[model samples]
Target chain A: MAGHKIDGTAIAKSIRERIHAQIKEAQKLNPRYKPCLKIVQIGERPDSSTYVRMKLKAAEEAGILCELVHLPSSITESELLLQIQNLNNDHSVHGILVQLPVPNHISEHTVTSAVAEEKDVDGFGTMNIGELAKRSGKPLFVPCTPKGVMVLLKESGVDLRGKNAVVLGRSDIVGSPVSYLLKNADATVTVCHSHTQNLSDFVRRADVVVAAIGKPGFVKGEWLKEGAVVIDVGTNYIPDTSKKSGQRLVGDVDFDSAIEVASQITPVPGGVGPMTVAMLLQNVVDATTAYFDKQKARHVVPLPLKQLSPVPSDIAISRCQHPKLITQAAGETGIAAHELVPFGRVSN
Target chain B: MAGHKIDGTAIAKSIRERIHAQIKEAQKLNPRYKPCLKIVQIGERPDSSTYVRMKLKAAEEAGILCELVHLPSSITESELLLQIQNLNNDHSVHGILVQLPVPNHISEHTVTSAVAEEKDVDGFGTMNIGELAKRSGKPLFVPCTPKGVMVLLKESGVDLRGKNAVVLGRSDIVGSPVSYLLKNADATVTVCHSHTQNLSDFVRRADVVVAAIGKPGFVKGEWLKEGAVVIDVGTNYIPDTSKKSGQRLVGDVDFDSAIEVASQITPVPGGVGPMTVAMLLQNVVDATTAYFDKQKARHVVPLPLKQLSPVPSDIAISRCQHPKLITQAAGETGIAAHELVPFGRVSN
Candidate 1:
């Protein structure tokens, strides 16, 4: 039986459309309101350039202001850090992302740590990852790929609670964070890595399998539990002379065989890729909304009062003061007019 | 078949003796070299007092300066925070520990985080635990209980590499950090909690099991794989009419039943309990040694030299300068004479 294919492209598109509409709606109330993302790219790596371009185009399509700050390969580590600090201090930029695979001369750890935690859209900093691992931690923003994987799982209607989840690979970016997310969702999570023995024995019993080992077709269909949900995060290139590029993108799971057993599965190229960009855009929107909400909440005005000459009884004092309407109070607290619900009139 | 009892009490005693000897050796060179621990205990909860006394006795026995600052239960959170800050700023206090169960009014999170990360001997702070969770993170100090568990595992001759290990808890204290440690050591780890289904199936295939769910005898011996190693961290008090106190301490695993099937097991009263105080004293010593090492490292003196009229070739310049003996150089670099091994005569 052919398993149901998870249409990641459609899901990602719908999410992007929702984000675009939300941004447009926010702009309608305040024309100046706009979510902004700044990407810091170093060197002229072809792959890095391609990813940056994809992000730029996606951000623009989602009504976000995206800017690329490309620097020369010869830039010193201190100079790179200064650039990130400037972006961090800029109130206009809601999200800051430092493209990975930085020049060998520059330390990736230092560069990633330089991004302010609040504006760290990539969420690769120690603070964010550390919080994600904590049992009751509240991270400001989860990493894009892991966050996207969670969305795909939810969209597929998989109830993670009490389910056995086996995560292959333990990369800080994908495997570790996703396992933490699965555990946080109440799934019994087993993290299998390069050193894991009897790896198939683990996958064979898992209710859900997330493969991110970066090896093409590393996970076989026979290893998966029948009707299991498979989300492959690997993006490996294998030789395919029939293709124009002479190579084709594949995931850790062999799709042909997995589709025969999995109840739901995501394809390689279009699966996790598009969702990453969508989640990045969503994080920017959320940060911008939070910024504006804080600004509006600060607009609360103190009510003026007439001082009485003599102190009155508590009942008399309460009767003397005039109370504002519930709607007026709601407005003062930054609640939108459309959000207010009136439950009967206040009695005198 | 009966399993070997992991005598944590004997292991802890040996470790404390080594620490005591090390401190005495250090004092031989510098009489003032002393590791100090300041434990801030809120209220007078009998259990808390008992634990504090155990820690104090263990620390003093290990040649550490232990001090207890007993605060009233009525103290506000801010006041408690102020006390922690004072301890944090005190260079003389190498380790600062705040006893748990502060008070109903005080926030435990706030109190735990208030202790400086450097002086956090208990290792309950977010920064320390966060570092522990990272792939290559070098935490200043790991939490005592988890650290003790690792020591017990090591003492039992359990090689974690490529092993299947099941952790039966997901707490910020024990289960979580130990799982991370095991994973870091290349063990395939599955973390099971209250929401886990088929928990016995997970434990049945494990090479090692660590139970810290606080439930007495929750893990059955039948669930254990033959010859599996068990590290029970539970300390539960059960009514025992045969005991003088009318109660007895038990672990998450039924020791009598577990021993019959397991290769090794830790008994509740003498197991993880004693190791906790031993690890705390070790952390205090480690912190004090680090403090002095940093001070000693900064004692390097600049060598003065005469300027040459004309720049010489590298070979010519090397022949003109006087060279100090290797021992002299080692001394300047804070290496003790006993630590140095002079290989030959340094080629004259």
Candidate 2:
């Protein structure tokens, strides 16, 4: 590591450790504090199965309980939804993930929408996605892979505010959601995809470049700005005669060229790949804990204030002020308002 | 004017004319057929009220009825939401629009979310936005200005597919959502914003550039590619002694130099400006038509089949299609029956 190589694996390990500590503490308060994850897999694809298997193993290593719910290829649409309804009602199954690319007879939208928003660990459900979209206006659980990417950036100590960031790919699963998260973090974000012209032009100007394209080695180092932070989200596998399994996994960035110019770079396997599943485990643990919180969080959200009728225009809630008050005081003292607010509280 | 100058005002007039024809046809079918729009204003912003009046006049000119629901500046949050709820439930009202930048007191999110998805002609609701985020998904109403940008591009006969496109803003109300629309329409899309480093480097390579930076003459023509299609979304007013109002509207691009180099460009005031309100009126009509198709459309959407338990391990959804029919076809073919099926599309 010439300058800085953001070790996603190490960062993920620290997060898992923190979560494990929280679990241990929670158990003391209540022995029933178990982090449980349930993955709903439809007709199987080898790649998906391998990914699901990796998640299960990772969850177990994190000391979280895992359950795999397998579905038949010939399963009917209503039956699949019924299973989701049951999972939604199950207090023990904290987080639920329905693997993608369902049968032609099924609708992915219907399947995704079926997962209760609280249990949507994959974060593809309509309500969950909608909540994420509106998160800047009000905070909500962000999607996992993007959440993991945010962790890697923050762990590396890069300032996100006002940073120009470009993301490759626009799939709802990664690109668009990541851009939204980056924007929410106060970073100026740009999303470029296949329809995008001259991809290198955008990449060369990025302070942070997130390459989520499924294509291997698509983001060349020359395409990057010198000393830029790089997060490689693609997990493309290519056949390799040298490997025992006749295959090897690589990322979207060209690692050799990237390491020379990057201020911080993540390696393919040890970087984003491990972090994705780790975040899922994190989501599962959070969902299980929240199940006990029940309607308390909802109740705590406060009623949406009295109707707009007969209300004075100047008296509307406007900026909720708890955070603004500190900023206002700092402003009078000539200190940056951000300096007054608690820093490093938003650990991913 | 060089070849790049597009008559946006003329195009908008044509689109508006087409909508008038549609409204007249609907009137023939039902005497009660009316494309009625409601404008809910919470504050007394001069510019916002001017915009509201423009929309109302446009609706009337296009053969649609309109009403203004004036709320005092001191309106309460719940009251505003209740008004939106009433508009949502009223079959007489085809579309609902709430003038933005409401008094600091009211929550934009709360107000936007309160509008029923069907009545949200502005297309700012969370559910509609979520729908906009998915593959093969279409929002009930695409936001006006961005949709207007598309109308201009299509009218100019620009082939969006495989073309390089860059947007110079990331506002959710414009840049971000519009980028998705451009990409979905098949142009490769890259969004460059304030966080971007060397913004010109990206602009220089664009086949198409949409300037929405809200800064007058912010994008220099030299940064533009030769023969580029320019769509300026910026509505900046610069103080000018030559103007009676002490100000004149200008777009983000330096139009003087841009017209000389570009194949097509939209002028500031008459270009995209007129198209915005036109799209709004169009959305009102669409909102009415959609209400008639809601139940029918939702019923056509099938549930997810993958969520069911005991999933098959062998066949993948994409790799194997119409399993039964393919299996039968293969069995008839007599060459290792039941395994091969063409993918992409399959009937239920």
Candidate 3:
């Protein structure tokens, strides 16, 4: 039986529509409210330009104000960092992203780290990645590609809880973060890389397979378990004499063979690729909402401090101050009562 | 047939001896060179005091200047933070650890994070834990329990490369970090926790099993694959009227049954307990050595900066400067030739 194909393009379109509606609602509340995204491209690399253009178009469609700042190849690392700093300081810009494969002179690590944690929509910075890796960490934004993969998994109606998930890469951008997401979702995730031995044995037992190794057809269909769900994150281009570009995009899975055995699969080019831009748009919207929420919260009146003679100890002062119930406080901050998990009476 | 005992107590002793000899050598060079550890204990919990006492004794035995600061339970978080700041600023203290189980009024997260990263020998802070989680991160110190577990595995001669390792529990201290360590060592790791369904299924295929779920005898021998290496990090206590304390320590795995099925295993009480204190002393020594190394490096002559007439761009200025070969630079920093992995000409 042929497997069902996960329609990422259609799913991304629906998500973009939701974002557009959300942006419209926000604008209705305050005409000045606009989610803004700034993309920094260091060089004129054709691939980088294409990706940036795609992001710009998607953001525009989603009612996000997307701006591209194209810097020359001769720009210095310090100059690039200065540009990022200016964007970081701008209150209008909610999301800032530095396109990858920056000039050799500019250390990618330094450039990515330069993005403010609040505005790091790409989620490549140490703080974001670190939070994603942590079990109890709350990352402001997850990297787009991994976030997109998770969306596909969710849309496909696959219950990750207690399932066996085998991630086929360990890259910081895709494999590592995705593994953490799966584990957090309660999947028994096993990360397999080049160093992994008997890779087929792992694939054969996996209930869900996410291949991001970037190799063309690295995972064979015969190696997959029957009725397994496959999410292919690879975007490798192999030579295709019939194609006008002389190459065709293929995923890490042997698609034709995998389609026959897998219960659900995501096709190359139209799968994980489209969802990335959609997720980026979503992250910008989320950041913009948070910014406004913080602004609203800033208006809250501060409690009058009652000073005691000789100044009591810090704990004594705190204990004397009556605090709002945690549930009430959470509600005031837009958190639903169901969303609050009380650990103890400290907040009571 | 019974499996061989891991003998963690003996291994830890040998490690302590190594640390002692190294400290003696450092002191011989300069009598002022002494590793110092400061452990802050809040409240008078019997278990906390016992653990702190054990650490103090072990650190002293390993030639480290160990100091315990006992604070009242009523002390506020700010006061405790102030004390930690003092230790952080103290040049004589190489390692600073805050004993766990602080009063409910004090946020453990805040207290742990307040410890300076360089002096956070406990490795519970966000920076250290985040670094530990990253793929290419260089954490200053791994948490003592997880570090000890790795040392046990190494001493037992188990090569983790491409091995199937199952880690039980997902606690940040032991389970999470140990899984990262195992994955970094090239093991295909599956982390199972309370929500995990059919946990036995994951364990039954493991080549190496690390149980830290804190439930006594949670993992049975039948759940483990024959000849698997087991490292139990649990220290659960159950009623034993026959003993004076009316309790006995047991591991997450049923020791008696596990020994019959496993190739090597760490017993309860004498196993992981001693190693924790040993690793703590080792971290202090390591920090002390790094401190002195930094001091020695500070004495190096600085390169004279050349100011050009036209005021060149940052990239141009950097490009004009000649950099020492990475091998030579690494050597100067005490990194051996074999330890350096050349990525590209950027370092040349």
Leading candidate by lDDT = 1
Question: Candidate 3, clashing residue pairs?
Answer: none
In model 2, which regions exceed 4 Å deviation? A1-5, A30-33, A61-63, A91-93, A130-139, A160-164, A186-190, A195-207, A218-226, A289-294, A297-348, B1-3, B240-246, B295-348
Off by over 4 Å in 1: A29-32, A293-348, B28-32, B295-348
lDDT by residue for model 1 (A166-234), tens: 999988789988989999999999999999998999999999999999999999999889999999999
- Over the stretch A102-178, how does candidate 3's per-residue lDDT look in tens digits? 88888887788789888899988877876777787778899999999999999999999989899999887899889
* Correct interface contacts retained, every candidate: 0.47, 0.37, 0.32
lDDT for residue A144 in candidate 3, whole number 0-100: 98
Q: Give the whole-model CA lDDT for all candidates, comma-separated.
A: 0.87, 0.78, 0.86
Residue A169 accuracy (lDDT) in model 1: 91
- Provide the clashing-pair count of each candidate structure: 0, 31, 0
- Poorly placed runs, candidate 3 (over 4 Å): A72-83, A103-106, A295-348, B28-32, B74-86, B89-92, B295-348
lDDT of 3 by residue, B240-327 (tens): 9999999998899898999999999999978988899999998998899887886667332223357898999999988875555444
Worst 10 residues of 1 chain B by lDDT: B339-348
